[model samples]
Target: MIELLIEQRRRNLGGGMSVGRVLPFAKRRMVGPFIFFDHIGPLDLVAGIDRSVDVRPHPHIGLSTVTYLFSGEIMHRDSLGYAQAIRPQEVNWMTAGSGITHSERLEKARAIGDHLHGIQAWVALPTADEESAPSFTHYEGNDLPSWSDGGVHGQLIAGSAYGLTASARTHSPLFYVHLELEARATAEIPSAFSERAVYVAKGEVEIGGERLVAGQMAVLKQGASSVSATQPSTVMVLGGEPVGERFLYWNFVSSSQDRLRQASADWKAGRMKLPDADDQEFIPLPEGDPAKPS
Candidate 1:
């Protein structure tokens, strides 16, 4: 059964920061253990426009932030006093073990105009590793594994595939790949991946006998291998070792619901340090949600 990872178009959240869509785990029907996914933007920025997404320091307990950009530039500052600028095709992997806060912003560029496109994903960590100290790494584009087959270009941005591993270090086993196929070209999904999905960014693709256009996500059922394109296209493939069963409440993910509750209270009480820097932004929790019962 091929399920669609419904596309939620970017919604304006003001401050020039908009979220494309928030996909909850329940809606995904349990493809690989990935509980949440967000497609941030293909949004454009104008020259001389002072815009930035300063997420004020907030807390995350048991997850990792995987930042991938196709265009534009972003400056990342975290609680560890780590400051890094990520360009297109690079991966900024930050793990929030017990708790941490940070922010991301668009850096001013010299180009006459600027275009911003990227995806931000939240991967749940294992139960035992939830409280581990925070850490961060930036993988340059050239450091990722790349290959050509059937006239198509592919890059292993994170995790491993086709006997190649990208430099991006991940806690749990996962695969994050970027494939650019030429017109009428074909590429294959290795059988080793425990589970996987195809997200078409540009052009069109055919997977498991179904056609997927830009912005559509085709999530594969278990035991199925191999995905090919009908036209020249670019797609992101993500999969990995299953995380088993867990609960996600707001920004906290844990095997026990009580842990999430405790973390929330700690964050609200200012027990945790917001990620490192002045420009960070914080996302407010929705009102009256029992999961966030203060």
Candidate 2:
């Protein structure tokens, strides 16, 4: 059964490039442990597109940033001194235990241009691990588990799903899978988790007989459910046990409001270090009180 339907809202990530932000909705804040989700472009980038479109160094804390691409490439540089280029099906998982600053640049696409599309989700760390040491890991595309059943093909991106466990390290119980369905193909949504949602990333899908187009997400109530592709479609299925209440502001996620304030002040005062390789410029803290949950 469906609980709530969420539509993507446009958010400018600076430099004229905008993304469809789907999570952290006003009515529905968190799904499982996922605190933030952004659907990047399926658009074709023109050669010579402004370098300003690259995401500059930004800070994050108390969460793990997962970046998975469907196409194109993004060079990721983090304060941990890790610089890696992620391509289709690859995953770049960075845990900002206490704090970390990083930047995503369109290094390859900037010259010849390319179709850049991906999903970036932030999983809030459990309260016990919130202050742990920061770390980063990169998983190759072929390293993950993949399965095919009839017309439904799926890859377990992280956590566990369909009895397949991904290689990407996770801090909690969750499931994140990428599914590609042919027209008329069907796949069942796992009922093992306490919370679950299906996001239509491309084409259309029918869940509980409701048609969901691209940019639409259906948060399902506790029960068994499945998705049928109205056409050739791409979808992401994710959810898990709830991590209880979390406070979010800007890029910080924490259970304590005071910690969020401290992070804001740390970044503003240059106490947090920037990416060693890409530290010439960084996104300044927004001009406002840190009381607001962004």
Best by lDDT: 2
Collision count for each candidate, in order: 13, 0
lDDT of 1 at 222: 68
Candidate 2: residue 256 lDDT (0-100): 90
lDDT of 1 by residue, 138-196 (tens): 98757788889787798888877889888866778888888888877777775566777
TM-score of each: 0.88, 0.98
- Alpha carbon lDDT of each predicted model: 0.72, 0.92
RMSD of 1: 2.8
Kindly list the per-residue Cα lDDT of model 2 for residues 112-153, writing each as its tens digit.
Answer: 988999899999999999998999999975668999998999
Model 2: number of clashes?
Answer: 0
